[model samples]
Structures are given as structure tokens and as C-alpha cells.
Target: MLDAALKQQLQTYLERVVQPIEIVASLDDSAKAREMQELLQEIAPLTSKITLTERRDDNERKPSFAITRPGTDISVRFAGIPLGHEFTSLVLALLQVGGHPIKLDAPVIEQIRNLDGAFEFEVFMSLSCHNCPEVVQALNTMSIINPRIKITSIDGGVFKDEAEARQVLAVPMLFMNGEYFSQGRASVEEILAKLDTAGGARKAEELSTKEPFDVLIVGGGPAGAAAAIYAARKGIRTGVVSDRFGGQVLDTLAIENFVSMKETEGPRFAIALEEHVKHYEVDIMNTQRGAKLVPGKLIEVHTESGAVLKSKSVILATGARWREINVPGEKEYRNHGVAYCPHCDGPLFKGKRVAVVGGGNSGVEAAIDLAGIVKHVTLIEYAGELRADAILQKKLYSLPNVKVITSAQTTEVHGDGKIVNGLSYKDRSSGDTHKLELEGVFVQIGLVPNTEWLKGAVDLSRYGEIEVDVRGQTSVPGVFAAGDVTTVPFKQIVIAVGEGAKASLSAFDYLVRSSVEEKELAPTTAAA
Candidate 1:
């Protein structure tokens, strides 16, 4: 059901419609389909220029909506219910169909217009994926401008077979011309670059091999960006190599713990970070992933694209990623009913039963959060007792909708070929197996650092995290690490920012000391 405030907002957004737009919804005898129909019906009457036509189609595999304008012969299709973060995509699609011009950079628009051959983009996504709407919107905007580009948004939950066949283990899995393009959150520039390379129309750029930079940041997350900004302020040549500018922050939903901000979403915060970095004179190399690290007098960073970057000092801010729970059906039902982020994917499971695997701080926190949204939550832990803090455990136990199970080892994830329906676990003490029925499973075990490339290049801890001292200096001189990739006790954004500042200052000190030593070692010139 649509809330009054949200209905008012949709009404306001629909005011931009210049002509009557028709939405043709094909529904089947399913609860999801009925829910989709109800959602459309609730919003259609808010705007006079919008019309909805529903038809019973048993052949329809899922609830599908086709959007068309008065004179447009081509119809854009959305093959799933758009809710949560994806609701914005539906609104934007409607506005674009209603004659609202898409706002994009001139060069980007030109590139889309000049694209050769027909490109069909099938974006598989989940309703709760915070990063999916941007991908959908970018392709939709391109489809509006270029007739050769066609966009189809598919819900991974409803089309599990297709998703599994494509090996879609992540959200925002894009298929361009039936080939896998990318996964996770990607910027428009990154998408365009990929398309250019795939089409064999990519133009090579000559990189300068002159004097190496004073400092090179290896990631584009908060820590790396902060280090770059600090280094640039010292009037030094700085460079940043990043596969995507925002890093894992792009997948984050709401960031309230960030200092000085009451509340901010991930995408908006990422844009702000990029904009802040652009204010400095740092050379930003986007879409470049570090493949290997070669440390020496001049550090060489080998990118996956086969380009080598040299710098005097390097800062590794490559963040950590969520650890995967290697259980049966986990991979097949990743976006369907198995998720990682509670902040991002929690709302989609509203009023539905879900399970959280782990009893640590993250797991307990997730349980407490999901209990507020979902109908019920079952928290399972392999340890005999909850490892979460006392306060967190207290809060978690106070929730009436939560049930905690200790010493339970999850063995297999069960699904009905469409979405996760249940899971099987074994009691560690009794060695007995048990099964629980739930619609979603949230894995919050731990994180694995993204420092595998630096294995031989720098010193690493037993857990593979980059070893750094209090000054953010690694074992190797002139090399520093920060953020989630380092040995910092806390992995919050604010703490990463502080660590980045420290690492940048340390690098600068090392440069200063090296310059003094070089001057002192130089032969004294005769006073002639």
C-alpha cells in the first residue's frame, strides 16, 4: 500500500508529464503479480495524464510493465516489481517517457548517439540493491536518446533461472548484447568505456613517463581520496588509480555515522567525494584496477589493463569486501533471497521472515535492525555464545520478533528455484540437523581484505590485512596503508579519513627526510 506522503511525492513528480503515458501491465495469478497490480493502481489515479491497462496473461513468466507514449512505437519494458531503491528508476522512466529530456554531459550524449550497431542491455537487479537504480537509469536515458540502444530491467528474484544461467552472483549485473558487461555499481563513464572497448572503437591515450609522482593512491575510497587531497595540498604531483571512484561506499545505503552530516545516502556521498577530489590537482585514473604492486626506489603499480604507473611513495587504501558463506544454493540465490548488506537490502524483505548468519556485532546489529522491518528474524551463531558486545546483545535480545540460536552451523541454503525459502543447519553440540523456513538470509560473518595483490610487495598480517603501525607506515619504507585494508582497529568511514590524513603526512615526512639526505650526501661545490 502507498503511504500518503509518498503518494503526494509521486503526484508532484508526475507534473512534468507533457502527454498521456500508458503503462501496459501483464499479470499472472501470483502474489507478487497482485502486489504489482495494486501498486500501479494506487499510483495511477494521482496523475491525470497517466493511464494503466492490465491484462491477464498466464504466459507471462513474471509481472511485466511496458511503457509507451502517444506517438512512440517502441515500448520500454520492465520485467519485475520495482520497489525500495528501484522505485526511483520507475519514476525516472515515466518522466523520460513523458517527454522530460534526460540531462547528461554533451560528450557522453554524443558517444551514445554515435554508438554503432544495435545494443540491447538486460540489467538483472534486485529491488533492494542500492546500486542498481543508477545502472538502470543510465541505460534508460541512453535508450531514450539513441534508438539503437534498448533497455530491459529484469528482477533477479522473479527470474532466478535466467540469473543463475548468466552466473549473476551480484546485483546490477549488466548484459550488453547478450554478453556480460559488468557487475555491482558502475558509473556511466565506466560503462561507456567498457562499451567502447567491447565495440573495438576505443581510442588509446598516451601516458606520460616523465618524473614519477610524489605519491600515488591506489584506491578511490574515502581513505585514498583523503590521502590524495592531503598530498595535493602540499603542491606535489599526486596520482590516483581506481577501478571505480567510490569503491565500496557506492554499495552502501545510508551513511549516518559520517561526521558533520546528519544523514546522507551512498550515491550522493560518493559524488561529493569525487567532486572534492576534483578540486585538487591530482591526476585521477578511473577504471584502472591494480593487478600487482612492485616496490622499489620508485613504486610501480601494474594495472589490470597492462599499464604501469610509477610513484615515489604509495598508499594502499583498497578496502575490505564481505566474506561469502560457502554453502549450497548460496551462489544461486545471491540477489534472490541471499544478501550481504542489511542497510541496503533490508527494506525489500519487509513483513517477510529472514535469517542472519553470525552472532558477532555485525550480525547482532543486523538482527536488531531487520526486526524493526521484517515480520521475524532468526539469528544463528556457530559459536556457543554471542560474540557481540554486551550492549548490542542486550538490544538484540530485547526485540520480541528476534530468535537467536547458538552453536548452529549452517550447511545448505534452500530455495524453490526462484527465491530462497529456507536453510538447513546442524547443531554443533548434538550433531543433529535442523531446518528453518525463511524468505531471506543475511550473511554478516566478517570481511576479507582486498590486499591479495600486495602479498609479496608488503608485509601482511596473519589475516591478510596490510600491516601498518600507529603512523600508518607499513613494514616497507615509503609505503603506507589505511582504511579497511590496514590493521586499524575500527573500520568506520571517519576513522579511515583520519588514518588517511596520518598516512599522507607520514609520506610527506619521508619525502622531506629523503631530500635532506640527498642534499647532505651531495659533493660540496667549491666556492668559485
Candidate 2:
């Protein structure tokens, strides 16, 4: 299954294995099984440490393999072809299981080693989902750390019937033991926080004890990462706190507009950005949400976990998220048939009918993408005409399995208590109600800025976007905002990056002009 270049790369990576490992496969006489066998055979020769074996009697899940050391009870399994976005996850599992040292913090490794109880985690994920690899890789790493933990990354794309039976309409759906744990993207820290009951309070207490930063950037999106790099380069104390480092960027499918780079994936871009920032001496606290902001001499950013982080100057770079339709049954049926990411959850609705709400670029793109996957795609738009670009609209209309309805409003999502059965809409022109009998509803109504948390702390626009001046400075002194959360004209990654740099520079200027410490440290001569 691997190409010549890939074989060389795999061999090089396998050279890091310090211990022998085993691949115990549970498979049947199926095409996927044969493909997996071929993949395993090709990989085994790359490293002599790998010992491959098979079982005649398989478990409930077939076409799967487990990675483990000879004497270790720990396991990391893949229930399908772990290629596509999950290829990295497969590589990481092999390396870690073969005794290659993980590059995690010493404290986190220690915590995992000392973790209590047995955890059997099953993650239903799609190979096309860029977000699933992170969750799967995180669980796999944890499984290697603690022998009591076991992680199985299941491919919903291959096991469509099983996904439908479990009512898993979203990719990266998690199940602990046998009960549903969560849906959507998650990091190792987030997963650990949920597994341990008192982890939040303990983390809060630990974070609260840190010394104040000269520049504290909240949120770890592209904008926050840029701000961090700029501030850290100035030889000042810099720190960043975010619930998720990638933000909406992780949900993004592909980026063709980013300058220099012709085309790239969002998850890859976000990782490179994070890694670039890490090259500096900046402190990054991931999986921590800043709930409230206090504007003062030493601005305090209070986290949802009750952690109080103070800084001389603050930069708000929290990005945006998919806006919900908020119609009836929308909330109740979320992940049960309603989804936001077309790329991640599109395969789940294969051979079924689905409706994409909204008429703009995202909506049209979703309808076009789903038309090839689902049986039929009904595109509903609130406006009189589609706001998508001319080419996209043309392409959308050319699809045979796609239908576009303009001047229609989504009234309610219809579900039979378990999963979505259909949807209700209203025609603006005819003043009539319409219902679409479908299995899934994909909401693509654009984005809402993640600025609700800063409501009372800063001056926000009517749409809840932080009001920033030309310098990216907010209403409050020593507090700046950037990216989608601010009043930026265009919401692009490049623009966010520039705004972030501007915000960091503005914050540094404010700190030097007001603080006695900064004044003493400031250079006496003018710019050369």
C-alpha cells in the first residue's frame, strides 16, 4: 500500500524503534482485510523489530490490528485502513509502541504513567476527517504511556452500517467503555481532563501560580500564534492560553488562498504555525479557555477552569466558529444527523439524502461535495438568490443529485427522537411551508466570531465582534484584539496574521509607555 518514497520514509522512522513489537491482526476474508495484510507485509520488512501474527477467531470488530510490545499489556488498535489523514497516527502508534520516546512534557508523561483505572476508548472516525487524526493519535499515545488504557480508532467510512446503527453522524465520535463520551475534535490534554474528575481544579490551581507575563495572547489560532511569535521575538515574557490551539482552522478542509503556499490543508498549516511559535521561548498552555477578561494595570484573564492568568499587556485572538441555525430539533439531533463539517461527516450520510442550509460559498461547496457522497443534496438558502461565487453556483446547479432552493428559511429539523428524519422550511415568496425527507442536515450558515466571552470587558460590535482601532488596540488600554474576533475588514488567515503582529506591537508600545520596568529596559537611542 506504501509507495517507494513512503517505504524509505517508514524505514527511516522505524529505525528509531528501541524495542521489539508485535502486530496481532484480527481479520476476515475481505478486500479490506487483504489490503491491510498487504500493508502490514510491506511495513514488516522495513523494520526487523516488528513481529506480525493473526488470529482465526476475530473480535466483534473485524479487519483490525493491534500494536503492542511482547511484554506490555498496553494496546493501540486500528479498525480499518489507517491511511489518508490517519497515516501519521499509524506511524506514531508504531513508533511509540516500539519504545521510541514520546516528546511530551515530563510532567504529562508522569501523570499518564500514574493514571488509575482501566480505559477502553473507541473512536469512530472518518479517514477524510483531518480532525480525527489528532484525537486518535492522542489516545494512541496515552495507551502507550499507561498499560491500563486501550484505544481503538474505528473507521466509520468503511463501517457505515455500524456508524448508522450507533447513530454516529459525526466524525471523531468518542465512546468510553460502551457509553458515548463526546463528539468533535479533542486533544490529549482535553481527553485527560475528562478522564480525571479533579483534573480541572488541579490544572486551574497549577496555572494560577505562574508568574505574570509581559504579553499574554489568548486563543491559539493563526492570529494568536502570530502574536506570540512577534511578542516573544521582542525578548519579553510571552504566554498563550487556548481551549484548542487550532481553533476553527482545524475544521477547515483546504486552503488555496494562503500566499506563497499554493495549496495546503488547515490542520497541517495550524501544526506548522504552532511548531514555529514553539521554536521561540514562549509558554503555551493548551486546552485552557479564557472565560472573562479584566482590564487593569496588570490585566487578568480568568479561565473557565478558575485559573487566573495576569499579564502586563493582553492580545485577544480568539477566532470564530460555525453559526447554528437554531431551529427546532437542531440542538436535539446534532451528531444524530445534524453536522457542521461536510468534509468530516459527509461519508456518514452516504446513500442517504441530506440538506445543506445557507446559500453562500460554504453552503454551495457543501452541497457540491455531498452530492457525490449522499444520494441527494437539497441546498436551502435564506436569501432570494445564492450568494456563492458565480463559478460555484454554476457548478452546484450542474450536479444532478443537487437541488437549490432560494428565499427559503430553515424552520425546524425533524427527527424521530433518535436521529434526523427530515427538515421543515418556509418559502419567503409563497409564504408556504416545505419539508425535506432526509437523513442528515448540514448547517453551513457561515461563522460567528468567538467574542461572546469578552462582551462586558471590551467594546463589541452589534454582531459581538470586538471593536478594535487601526492599531488593533481595543477600547481598554493594554488590551488588544485581532483576527475574526476583532473588527478586521476581511477574515482571512493572512489578514489575521498581520493583525496579530500589529496587536503585539501595539501592546509592546503600551507596556513601554506606561510601565516603569519597561521604560528602564527600553533603548535610549532612536531607531537606527
Candidate 3:
């Protein structure tokens, strides 16, 4: 049945576009076909008149639309539901009718054209995940470039049963035919390779693949890889599931103090941890997300688009996102001159003038770090004084190239559309405005915890950080938290890693105690 609101929306669209296109439904019921035809006529009145055509043969049925207008060449043919990447098909059909080619990057276009044959793709997605949007866009782009790819998208909440049956735990899963291809957000090149491999892999081998984890971790960041190592070494089955294989650690440039290691980069430290964890034969499901979390004594963990992993417990090592400077043009010049992590994007501004915003310890530390690399470092603080420790403040003051501008706030960001050239700021005390020309701006403003999903799952501090005890036990029993998401004072990578280890150990001990208590009550239940 057509809803009244949808019928009204169709009418509005028809009035706005003032373009008429033919529509035909292939359903066997004559009344249903007539209803659909009437709905389109009400929505797109300017197009060629809608007509109901009866299907003579079920096998030969095809929904066709022909657009014959001045300066427009359009044709649409549909054999199945337009879902997943099929959303692109709908857009392309519109473009073809409109007689305009949608421009796309050459690399992405080339990847799509390389597909061997008609491939079926089923993607289960959640609207909440950050990277899922990118996956959907890429899939749509591929469909626009080529018509050989069949795509379907299923909303995780709406199609819970089907998703569970397919074992879709994470989003942006690409299922080629009936086989799972790849999961999570994939780049165009990566997806093309997965499609190629999916075509050649044996069905029996895919079904028989074994996972090595009682607890599978989906990130290689300090929390994830550390959890895997801890659980496996303690004689519990464990595995690491990750997308980049190195996690965010790969992006970190210099880690001056991670406790034991005096100096380390994010990539090197992650590699070492991976190696340490691998020595215990803990399976590493590289390039995957914990797609599904099935509840039971032995919980099942699903990957981006692959098999379910059976585990007794699960931990989220997925960390926080760096805060963005919301000033105009900041996003436009992210990699060019504006950045979030001084450790990741600082060196690129070497020997150039730079500014760091915020008065927290991270902000002060970032300014100090940039001072060593860039010709001049400007520390902009909205507060009256620096919030960093006295020691760090003294060190920052000692740096000759560093200038501390207290009670100053960045009001606007100016860029040449390619790189940030200058910025305007306001002095809180004098109400004076001044502009400074700089090559780079590092936003060392604090990070926001990625805890939007934990709506009521755990207790959070006033700052939205998870409230965990010293032992890392959260308000919830089976659920534990660590790292930046927790209410830990210092937001250092080393501190986060240490907390992750502690949290895992605590969770492990709790699991053992639970098992013994359950066993102790078993005999009494049998007697009853």
C-alpha cells in the first residue's frame, strides 16, 4: 500500500522538476500496476504520460523508462531491486536521462571498468558508523562507472534476522555472490582486489576457515593489540581484527614517551606489538571489524563481511577522534596546512610558521613539538594562562621560537584554497583584532571520545569519558573500558596502552570467577 505522505512527496517532485518520464511496474496484479502508474503521474506530471503495461511473459519482464527530450538522452532498465551500490544505478539512470556524465576520479573509474563479470554485492550498514558513508559512496561510484556490478544495501536494524543469518557483524561488507568478500570501509583499489579474489576463491575453503580467538580484537591501536596479547598469553584463545593492520598508531609520527620506549613512532610501536602478539599464535583478522556481537556463553563476533568469531567476551579498543577546528576553511585545508595531531602532521610544516590552538597540556606540548620543526610556533590560548603543568610551561617558555599568546582566540581561518596562508584572531583583553600569516595550523584541542554508541550502555563522566575504576572496571559487569574514552587524567598514548592492559587483565579475572561460580551451582540444579 502506498502511504499518503509518499504520494504527496511524489506530487511535489513532479511539480518541481517539470520533466516527464515513463514508468512501468512488473507486478502480476493489475490493480497494483495501475496504482503505481497513477502515483508517478501525480508526482511527475510534465513527463510523458504514465501507462500500465501487462507482462506477457514473466521471464521477459523488464521495467523500462525512455526519456526523449531536447538536449536529454535517457534510458533506464531494471531487472532487480536497486540497493547497495544500486543507489548509484538509480543516479546514473537519472544522469543518462538528463544527458550529463557524472565526473569521477580517473583511478576510481578505472577500477570499476576492470571488474570481470556480473558480481552480486550485499552490504549491511549502520548509519552510526563514521566510515560507512565512505563505503556507500565508493560503491555507488563504482556502479555509475560500470553496470556489471549488482548491489544491495540492508539497514542493520530493519533487517536484523537476515543480517544475523548472513553473519553480518560490521558494516560496509561486500558479499560477492553468496561468499563474503571484504568488510569495513575499503578503498577503491582494495575493493577491486577483493572482488578479483572473491571470484577465484574456492567455496569450500571459504566456509572451512577457522578463527583463533576466544576474544577477537578489531583494532591494533594500544587497546586492541594489547588486549589480544594479554588474553592469549593468559591461555585464553584470542585474535586481533584490524583494518589498517597497524591501526591509528601508523599515523603517529613521534612518541617521545610511551613509558618503556623513550622515543617511538606510532607505526614502529604498533609493528612491535603485532609481532609480540603474533608469537603466541593469536590469529590476526587483518582488515576486519567486529561486525556482530551475538550474546551467549560463547559469544559470536562477526567481521566486516566475513565469518562469525566465537568468543567468551569482547572489548572495544576503538578510540576517540581528534577534535577539529570548526573555523571556516579549516576542513578545506586539513592536510595542506591545518592538522589535528602534532605527532602525525607536525613535521610537514618544518621550517615554516605555525600556530597551535587550545591551552591544555596537549596544546602546550604540540606547540613545543612544532617549535623544534617549524621556524616559528605561535601558541594561541583562549584562557588567561596556560593549563599545562608548570614544568611543561617553563620548557615551552625556554623555546626561543615559541611565542605564547594568552587571551587570544582564533576567529577565522584564511586559506588560498590550496594551503592555509594566514589567520585572524581576537585579543580578549584589549578587544583588538590582528592577522598573522602562517604556513600551518595545528589544532591541539582535546579529542572527543567515540562513545556516541554507548547511549546508556555505561556510566560516563561529565566530560563524556567512561567512568572506570583504577582496575578498569566500568559500571557494567561484562563490559569494561580503557584508553582515551575513560576518565583518565593524562591523555597520553602510553597511559592509554597501560590502561588497556589493566582493563583486559581485570576482565579476564572476572571471567574466570564467573565460570567457577556457574560450575559450583550446576550440581544443585541437577539435584533439583
Best by lDDT: 2
Ordering by TM-score: 2, 1, 3
Against the correct fold, how does model 3 do in TM-score?
A: 0.55
Task: Tell me model 1's lDDT, rounded to 2 decimals.
Answer: 0.84
lDDT of 3 by residue, 112-172 (tens): 6877777766665543333344455455456546656655554554444565466553454
Residue-level lDDT tens digits of model 1 in 318-430:
88888888999999888778988876567667788999999998899889989998999999999999999999999998999999999999999999898899989999999
- Which segments of model 1 are wrong by more than 4 Å? 1-114, 124-128, 154-170, 173-183, 198-211, 327-337, 343-353, 368-376, 389-395, 398-401, 412-424, 431-440, 523-528
Candidate 2, residues 1-528: lDDT per residue as tens digits? 799999999999999999999998888988998898899988988889999998759664788999889986967899999999899999999999988889889878777887889889999999889899989998999988897888889999777788888989998999999899999999888898888758778889999999999999999999999999999999999999999997888889889998999999999999999999999999999888889999887899999989999999999999998999998899999999999999999988889999999998989999999999999999999999999999999999899999889999999999999999999999999999989899999999978998878888899999889999999988998999999898788789999999999999998988877877767878898788
List the candidates' TM-scores in order: 0.78, 0.96, 0.55
lDDT: worst 10-residue window of model 1: 199-208
Candidate 2 Cα RMSD (Å):
3.5
Better of 1 and 2 by lDDT: 2
Q: Which is better, 2 or 3, measured by lDDT?
A: 2
How many backbone clashes are present in model 2? 0
Error of 2 at 61 (Å): 1.7
Model 2, CA-based lDDT: 0.91
Please give the lDDT score at residue 105 for candidate 3: 52
